[model samples]
Target: MNLKIQKISILLFLFSGLSVFSQIKEEQLILDKKREPEVKKIEKKKTSVESIKNYPPEEKSQNPVEYSITNVPALSDFQTSTLQADDISPNLKTDYYSNYVRFGMGNYGKILGDANVSYTLENKLEVGADAHINANHGLQNIYAWDSRQTSLKAGAFLNGYGEKGKYNVTADFGQENYNYYGIYALNPASDVDINQKVNAFRVKGSYDHFSNEYLNNITFKSSFLSDRFGAKENKGALDFNFSKHDLELPLNDVKMNADLGLGLETQSTDFEILNTNSSSYFLGNLSPKVTFIKDKSYLTIGSGFTYLSTNESNLSLDRKANKTYWFPKAELQLAKSDELKFYAGVDGGLSLNSYASMLEKNLYIVSDQRVTPTETKYNVYLGIRGDVDELIKYDVSIGHSKVNDILFYQTNNLFDTSIAAIRNAYDFANTFSAIYDNGTKNEVNASLQYFPRENFNVSGSFHYINYKMENFDNIYNVPTFSAELGAEYTLLNKKLLLGFKGFMASTMVTNLYDVTNTGLSTNYTTTEQLNTKFGGYVDFNLSAEYKIHKNFSIFAIGNNLIGGNYSTLQGYQVLGAQILGGLKVSF
Candidate 1:
C-alpha cells in the first residue's frame, strides 16, 4: 500500500511540470503572432514611401480623375458579304492560212488570176511558188490597145542553227511578161504589138557568228543576181561585217559600239539595140562606223570609201571615179512617253541605179539607155510619232535632202523621122527616156491610223514635196502633193469585210514636142516646144468579201467608182468604172 501511494505522488508531480512547460510555449506563440501584424504594416508603409519618392512630379495631381465619351457615331445597317464576277470575255484569236488562189473578171474584158503555195520540209527548209496574171482588152476610148502582165516566182530557203552561229541559203527564180500598149492615144492607126519580158534568178547565202568577248559578232554574205531582158545584166557581190556591241568606254554612263564593213561587187550589162554594146562595172566599198550612246541620245560618226570602175565599150575616157563620203548620224529623243515621242536624225548614202531597176520604175524606158549611180549628200529630218489613245496613232515628219544625179523620166525624141507618114507613126511611139538632174528636195509627210472599234479600221496619209532643179525650170511628171485614204470594216462575226480607198494627186507637168531631129536630145533649138499638164485627179475604189467557209470566200471589187475620166501619166488614160467578182480559196 505504501509503495503505491509514493508512485501516485511522483506521477502527479511529473504531470504538473509538463503543464507548466506547455503554458510557457503558448505565451511565446501569442507574442510572435502580435509582432507579425506590426512587421507587415511596416513593410507596407515602406513600399508606399518608395513609390511616392520615384513618382513623376507632373503626375502628382490633386484634382479628382474624370472620364467622359462624346460625339459617338450612330450605328446603321451594314452588309456582311458582297461579291461579283467579271463580265468581259477574252479576245478571239486569228487563224492563219498559208496558200491561196484567186480569180476574177471585169469590164473591158479584164481578167485576173493569182495563186501561191508553200511547203515546209524537215523543220529547216521552206519552199514557195507564186503566179499572177492580169489582162485587159482595149477600152472604148483608147482603141487597139490590149494590155497584159504575167509574173511567176519560185524560191527555196534553208536555215541552220548551231551552237555559236547561224546560217541561211536561198535561191529564187522569177519570170515577168508585159505588153507596152500605151501608144494608141498618140497614134491610133499604128500597129500595137509590142511586148517586154524579164527573167531573173538569184542565190544568196549568209552566215552569222556570235560571241560575248572582244569580237561580238561577225557576218558574211554572198549573193548573185541575173536579169535577162532584150538587155541582160548579171551581178555578184560579197560582203563582210565585223561588229562589237556594247563595248566599254572611258566615259561614265556612256556606251560605245563599232562596225566595219567590206564589200565587193561586179556587174556586167549587155544592151541589144541596133548593135550590141556592153559595159562592166567593178565596185568596192569599205565603211567604218562608231556609235556613242548616252541615255536617250546617239551619235554615229562614219565614212564610206568607194572605188568604182566602168569599162564601157563606147565611152572609155569618163568611166572610172573614186569617192570618199563622210556621214554624220545623230538622234536625240527629246521626249518619249506612252503617248508621244520626238526625234531627229540625219542620214545619207550612195545608191546604185541599175538598168533593171530603172526599167522597173518606168517600163517605157528606151532599151539603149545610160545608167549611173545616185549620190545623196545628206538628209535631215525631224519627226514626232505617238499614239493618241488606245485606238489611234499618228506620225508626222519633215525632211530635206540634197541629191546628185537624180533620175527622171522623159519622152524619147530621137525616133527616125524620114517619111512624113511613117515618121509620124514612129514619132508617136510614146516611149520614155531617163534623165539625171542634181536637185534639192523638201518633203513633209503625215499619217494617221484609227481603230474606232474592234472590227473597223481607218487610215490616211498626206505627202507634200518641193523639188528644185539646178539646171531646169521644171521637173516633169512629178506631183507636188498627194494623199491617200483607206477604210475597212468587218461584220457578222468577221464573215464579211468591206473596204474603200481613195487617192488624189496634184497637177504634174509634161512637155510635148515635134520630133524634127534624130538622136535623143533635150535641146530646145531642134524641137518645137509644147507644154502640157496631167494629173490633178482623184480615184476611188470599193471592195467587199463574204466568207462562206473558214478557208473559202467570195469577193467583189468596183474600181474607179466615180466614173471620171482621168490620166495618171501624160498620155495613158485609165479605164472607166468597172466591177469584178472573184472567188478565194485558202489552205
Candidate 2:
C-alpha cells in the first residue's frame, strides 16, 4: 500500500468514521441529560418582554431554503410553516435554481439526468450538489415490467456565515431510489419488489445584538432523519429546536412583534410489509409565533402544542390524550408598484387531539385507530405584481384552501396482502377516515411580459387548479388547467437566440381514485383519487453564440421543441421533445 500510503489509509478511515459518529452523538446527549426532568414537564411555558406588546424590528435575513432573497430568513419565528417572501419572481425560471449539468436523449427512448452544483467563499463558505434522474419505457413495451420504471435522487449541502452578523452554519445530505416491475395485470408472473432508503441531516445557529432601539435575536435548529429497508431495521428521526425574537417598536407604522419557540422530536421504526412487524412511534411539537407589521398591513397570531406516543406493533390510538395546536397568520400589502402592486395573505389552524374528546375519547382505541387525530385548517392568498414600461411585465396569483382530519387510502396495500389477515382477525383498522366536511382548494396564476426590441422577446403563462373534497369518501373533485406560451429571438447581429414554447394541461375535472388505489399502508383510497388526466405540449429552444474572441465565447442548445406527448402524472409519461447541448467558458 504505497500510493501515498493509499491516500493515507483513506484519510485514516474517514477520521475513524467521524470519530465514531462523534461518540455516538455524545452518548445521545448523555441520555438526553438524564431525560431532563421528563423533558421539563413536557416543555411549554414562556412569556416575558414586559408581559408582551410593542416589539417589532428584527428581520435582517435568516433561514434560506434555496429560495434566495438576500439570503432569506425572518418571519419573526414560528419556525417557518410556509408562505411569505412575496412570491419572489425575477421572470420566474426553473431548473430548480441551476448551477447546472443536464443530459438528455429522446425520440421515443427517453432518458435524462440533471444536476446542480454550488460553492461560495469569501462571503463565508458554502458547498452543494443536487441530482435527478428520469427514465422511459412507454413508447412500446410489450412487457419487462412495462419495460423499466425507475426514479433516483441525490443531495448535499453546506453553509457557514460569520462576520459581525454573529454566526451561522448548515449541512445536509439526501438520497432516494424507487423501482417497479410486474407486467401489470395483477403482477403477471410478479416479482413485485419494494425499496426505500433515505438519510437527512441539518444544523443551524444564529445570534445578533444591537443598541439604539434595542434589538436581539437568537436561534438554533437541529435535524436528523434516516431510513433503511431490505428487511427493515434502520429508521430514525430526531430534531431539536430553539428560537427567540426581540424588537423595540417605533421603527415605523405601528409595528409590533414578539416570538418564542420550543421544539423536540423523536421517531424510530422497523419496517416489514408481507411478514408483519410494526412499532416505534413518538412525536412532539411545540410552537409559538407572533407578529404585527403595519406598513402595507400585517398581523399575525399563533399558538401550539402536540405530543404523541406509541409503542404497539400493529396499531392503536383512538384516544390516549395529548394534542393541541393552534396557528394563525395574516398579511396585507399594496406596494402599488409605481405601476401596480397588490398582495393578500391568510393562514389558519386548529388542532385538538386528546383523541378528539368525543366524550372522553375511545371510539376505536388501541392507539390511533388508524389515525385521524383532529384538524381544522384554512389558507387564502391573492397577489398582483408590477412593471410596465421598459417592455412590460406582470404577475398575478389567487389561492384558496381548507382541509380537516383528512386521512385516506384503501388498497393496493403495496403487496402486503394484509399479511394473511394478521393472524386471522379482519378489520385491522389500518386505514379509513372521513372528517373532511371541509376540503377545498383553488389556484389561479398569471405571468406575462414583452420586450419590443432590444433582442426581441415575449413571454406568457396561465394556470388554474382546483380540488374539492365535498363530503369525502371515494373522493373526486379535481380541476386543472395550464397554459404557457413563449418566444425569444435574437439575431445574427446579437449572436443568435431563437426559442418557441407552448404547453397545455387539462382535466377540467376528473377522477378515478386519483390513478388507482393508493398504497404505502393504504390510506382510505388516495393519491388524489386516481389521477384523472389530460395533456398538452409544444416546445422548441435554440441558442447560438460566437464572439470567437473576448472572455472566450461559443454556445449551443436545442431542447424538446415539439416532440409532443404529455403525461406529467398518472402512469407518468414525459419525453417527446429531447436534445441536449452544452459548452461554456467565462472569466
Candidate 3:
C-alpha cells in the first residue's frame, strides 16, 4: 500500500466523522440566578428554630386553614428512591485504610494521608479535602506500578457540592507533584531524574422546581478537567425529568422505565518524549443514551459519534494531515434477585496515520504502524453474587475486550542511527500494540470477593491478556493478580478502635514465542522468565473519643503502628511507622 493512498483513505474517514459531529445540538447558555425565596426560607429555618416546635394554640387556632393539604400535589406512582452502598466487614474496613501505611522488610519509607475530612456549609452544600505527600530518600516502589523505580506524587483532591434540583453550587481543585529517576522503560540503571506536576478543578450547579409529569423537572450539569500528562478534557450535559424514576417502564411482572440524554465532549492530549512530540484526539462528540429498567432486571443502550483528529509534530516526519474518527458504544444488563447480575457492552472506533511516539516519523511505518485510520472494537462481561442477607457475601465477574488499529508506544536501541534515533530512542523505537490487518487485539479479566462480616473481608482479581504486535511474533499472554484483606474492631465502649488491612499482587508473561522486540518495549522486558514480587503490611491505629461531659468530647488518634514498608508503584517508597497523634475538642 502506498503512503499517499493510506493518508488519503484515513483523511476521508476522519472528515466523514467530523461531519456527524457538526450536527450536535449547541449548548444552551446558563444565567446564574440569585437564591430564590424558598431557598432563603430553608436557610432561615435552620438557624431560627432549635427543633420542630409544636404550633402554639393561638397561632394554630387562627391559621388552621393555612395548613390544609390542597397546596401540595398528590404523590405519584413514579416517585421512589433507591440507595445502595458497598458493604464491607469490620476486617475489610480496617485493612482498607491500614494498607495505606503498610509494613514490611526492604521497604522504602511511608506516604501519608490515608484518611479524609469534610465539612458542611449552608444551603445543603458540603466541602471535602484529601492530601498525600510521599518523600523518600532512595529508590522505592511506594506508588510505582511495578514497585521497581523511585518517585513521588504529592497531591490533593478537593470537592464542592450541590444537587441536580437543589439551588446550590459546588467545586474543587487539586494538584500533583512528580519527581522520578527514570521514565519506566528508559535507563532504569541511570540516575538521571525528571520532575513534573499536574493540576485540576471541577464545579457544578443545579436548580429545583415542582412538577406534575416526568418531563417538567430539569437539571443541568457540566464539568471540565485538565491533566499535566498532556491531556485536557471538558464535557457538559443537561438532564431534565419530572420523576427520577420515569425511565422505569412497566414490563410484565416487573416495573420498567427509560431515560434519554444528549451530551457533548472534547479532549486533547500531547505526548512528551525525548525526541518526539505529537497530539492525538477525539476533539468533539455527540452522544445519546437510553435505559430500560425492570425489577432487578434492566438494559441500557448508548452510542456516540466523535470528530477525531491527530496532529503529529516531529522534526523527522512530514506533518500527518488531520483526520476524523467515529466511535459507537452500547451496553446491556440482566439481573435476577439481589444475588445475581450480568452485563455486557462494546465500543468501536478508529485512528488515522497518528504518531507512534514523541520521536518517530509518521510517514515511514508499516501497515501495522500506520493504522488504516479505520478501526472497530467489541466487549462482553458477566457477573454473579450470593448471600446478600447474611453477614457473609460473595461475588464473581468476568470481562473480555478487543480492539482494532489500537495505538501503542515502543522503544528500540538497535534501530537507532541518526541523531533523532538517539535522542528519541525511547519514543520512536517503541512499537504500538499489535493490530491484525483484519483489525483487532483481545483481553480477558476476572475477579472474586468474599465478606464474612461488616468488620472483615477479602478479595482477589486477575487478568489474562494477548496481543498481536506489528512486525513481530504474536506477544505472549500476560497474567496479573491482586488480593487484599482487612478488619476493624472497636473497644472502650465503642469509643476506641483498631483497624488493619493488607494486599499483594503478582505479574507473569507466558508463551513469549518471540523475544526480538522484548527490549524495544516499555519497562524493558528482561529475563524471559518468571518474576515473583510480593509485599504486605498490617497497620494498627488507635482512635478514642472521651466524653468529659454532655454534648461534648475529646477525640485523639495514633497512626501506623507497625511502620510498614509498602510501595504502590515499583520504586516509590512509603513511610516507616511514624505516628501523628492529635486531639480534637468539641462542645
Candidates sorted by lDDT, best first: 1, 2, 3
Q: Write candidate 3's Cα lDDT for 511-567 as tens digits.
A: 211123344454323322222232323333333334333333343333333444443
TM-score of each: 0.72, 0.24, 0.51
Greater TM-score among 2 and 3 belongs to: 3
Residue pairs clashing in model 1 are none
Best candidate according to lDDT: 1
Instruction: For candidate 2, write residues 1-587 as lDDT tens digits.
Output: 45576456445533543343332110000000010011110111121111001122232433322222132211111000000000000111122232444454443344545454656566555565555554444434343333333334455555444432333344444332223221122323223332223344445555443221223445555544433332222222333333333344766655566654454444343333333334344555555656666554445566555566655454332233444455556666666343476768767654323212211111111112222343546678888766666466777889886766643322222223332222111122212222334577678888876777665566777888665666643332222666665555544444434444444444422232322334565333324333343333333333333434333334433333344443322222333334433332222
Show where candidate 2 strays beyond 4 Å. 1-106, 109-138, 141-338, 341-381, 401-438, 442-452, 458-487, 493-497, 500-567, 576-587
| Candidate 1: 10-residue stretch with minimal lDDT | 26-35
Error of 3 at 229 (Å): 12
Q: After superposing candidate 3, which stretches have Cα over 4 Å from the reference? A: 1-119, 127-132, 140-178, 182-251, 254-256, 269-276, 280-282, 287-289, 316-336, 342-376, 390-394, 405-451, 468-479, 486-492, 495-500, 508-587
Kindly provide the TM-score of model 1 when superposed on the true structure, using C-alpha atoms.
Answer: 0.72
TM-score winner: 1
Put down candidate 1 lDDT per residue, 1-587, tens digits, no spaces. 75676456445533543343232110000000010011110111111122211222222232332311111111111100000000011011124655677777777676666565655555434455555555555454554644444444555655554444446676666655555555622444435455566677777777655342233333333333333336777777778777776777989978987888788877777776633456777778787888887765567777777777767664333355555556545555554453677878877777667766765456556565666677788889998876655577778899999999888777665365343433322245466766789999899999887777776667788999988989867787777887776666666666766665566678877665553433354332236344467657666555667788877888777665555555555555555666777787777
Model 2 / residue 291 / CA error / Å: 37
The backbone clash count of each candidate, in order, is: 0, 24, 65
Report the C-alpha displacement of residue 480, candidate 2, in angstroms: 11
Error of 2 at 432 (Å): 21
Which stretch of 10 consecutive residues in model 3 shows the poorest summed lDDT? Answer: 76-85
